[model samples]
Target: MNSVRRHALTGFAGLALVYLLLPIAVVILFSFNDPVGRFNYTWAGFTLDHWLNPLAVPGLGEAMRASIEIAFLSSLTATLLGTPIALALVRYAFRGRGTTNLFIFLPLTTPEVVLGASLLTLFLNLGVSTGFWTIVLAHIMFNVSFVVVTVRARLVGFDRHLEEAAMDLGANGWTTFTRVTLPLIAPGILAGALLAFALSIDDFVITLFTAGAQTTFPLWVYGASRIGVPPE
Candidate 1:
């Protein structure tokens, strides 16, 4: 009976994963389908024209290029900034540590709409005209907290003894960090950076509020939905 229950539980979990991923799978499939659009789902044929075909649609290529650029820069900045914060939280004892943690976690709990609205107001008040850079700044602000949390998780299980050993072996702080500590935590930083990039690219509400005049890929898609996504 226990084994039967375990099998049933595993089956249910598998089904749940399939359900969650079904839409993504469909999008990936239909991205190559004939006459790619929300309406086209025949699966009758396959073509990569949608991805490669120039003049496929207006604004799409430009928006996609912009989104990629913004994602790379913003996620890179967030990871570089957040990694230090995470390292400090994991490795050091400091006054106001709880406050710092709270501030980092606060963004995760904040609603996207609220954060966007607030940022919009601040930019307006500061007389900061918005553009591609503004969007990158907004992406970094929202994505940094996630990076800090993720890298900290990797740091939690890490052995500090390696750093101590490196120090004992006459390696300086920078050498110990770059050679030993960084290599150990590099995967976690990379994973967090990828997550940040995805979030930055997929962002809609915050980008909408903060992007000002610049259009991102998702913004373009949302606008295009008003008019249909054109066939290539």
Candidate 2:
């Protein structure tokens, strides 16, 4: 009976994995398809044309570049801003600390549509024109919370004895942080930055709201979907 149950669980896990990966597998398979028409949905024949000429589609390269740039900027900014906040929250007991934590989590909990709409409204009220910078700002706003949470988690497991030891050895606070503390928490910082980059690059709804004329990769894909998405 235990053996049978184990086999059943294994089968279920395998099935779930396949279900999750089916779309990705299809996408990979279709990338090599040479479609005769604008739509690449139906596999006509396999060709290297799409791979050979990746920028055949207009604005595709530009959109990709814009997305990468935005992602990098937003992730860097979020990490910088969040690291200090994370340190503060973890190391210090301040008034309104709970409120600050609540606010930090609010963006993570809020629906993307609502957050996007709220950002749009705020920008309009402030007379800030929605464009490239606005999209970057919007990405930064959402990404910061993730950065803070990640770095805070890292700090929670940190050994304060290490810092105390460094100080006892005549190292100043800044020196200890730069040499000891920073290196230890670097993994969490990098992870948070990478997550922010992924979120910024993949964001569609929020980008759509904040972007007036600027187009990101997701935005380009969305526009292409109206006609037909090319596998490339």
Candidate 3:
């Protein structure tokens, strides 16, 4: 009975994995397809032409470059700003700590559509022009919350004795933080940065609201879908 149960669980896990990966497998398979028309929905023939000349389509390169730049800048800025906030919330007792924690979770709980609309309204009220910088700003705003949450989770399980040991060995506060605490929290920072990058690059609703003329990759894909999507 135990062996049978184990086999059943293994089968279930295999099915779940296939379910999750089926779409990705389809996308990979379709990338090599030589479509006869704008839509690459049906398989026609396999060719390497699309892979060889990925930027054959006009504006694809520009949109990709914009997406990469925004994702990098927003992720870096969010990580920098959020790391310190996570440290403070975890390592110190301060006024409004509870309120700050609540505010940090607000973005996570809030609907993306509502957040995008609110950001649009705020930008308009301030007479801020929607453009590349506006999109970056919006991405940073949302990314920071995720960064804080991720880093804070890492800090929650941190051992204080490592920093104490560094200090006991004649290290100053700055030295202890730089040498011990920073290294220990580096994984959390990296995880948060990667998460922010992914979120920024994949964002559509917020980017649509904030970007006036600049096109990111997701925005480009969305626009292309209206006509007919190219596999490349």
For each candidate in turn, give its C-alpha RMSD to the true structure in angstroms: 2.9, 1.8, 1.2
Predictions in order: lDDT:
0.89, 0.95, 0.94
Relative to the unseen true structure, what is the C-alpha lDDT of residue 160 in candidate 1, on a scale of 0 to 100?
92
lDDT of 2 by residue, 1-232 (tens): 9999999999999999999999999988998998878888897988887788888789999999999999999999999999999999999999999999999999999999999999999999999999999999999999999999999999999999999999999999999999999999999999999999999999999999999999999999999988988878
Screening candidate 2 with a backbone cut-off below 3 angstroms (N, C-alpha, C), the clashing residue pairs are none
Error of 3 at 202 (Å): 0.7
- Tens-place lDDT per residue, model 1, 110-212, is 9999999999999999999988988999999988999998899999999999999999999999999999999999999999999999999999999999998
Runs with alpha carbons beyond 4 Å of true place in candidate 1: 1-3, 28-55
The local lDDT score (0 to 100) that residue 9 gets in candidate 3 is: 100
| Candidate 1 residue-wise lDDT at 24 | 85
lDDT of 1 at 138: 92
Whole-structure CA lDDT of model 3: 0.94
For candidate 3, list the clashing residue pairs, or say none: none
Which candidate number maximizes TM-score? 3
lDDT of 3 by residue, 100-150 (tens): 999888989998899889998999999999999999999999899999999
Cα lDDT for residue 114, model 3? 94
Best by lDDT: 2
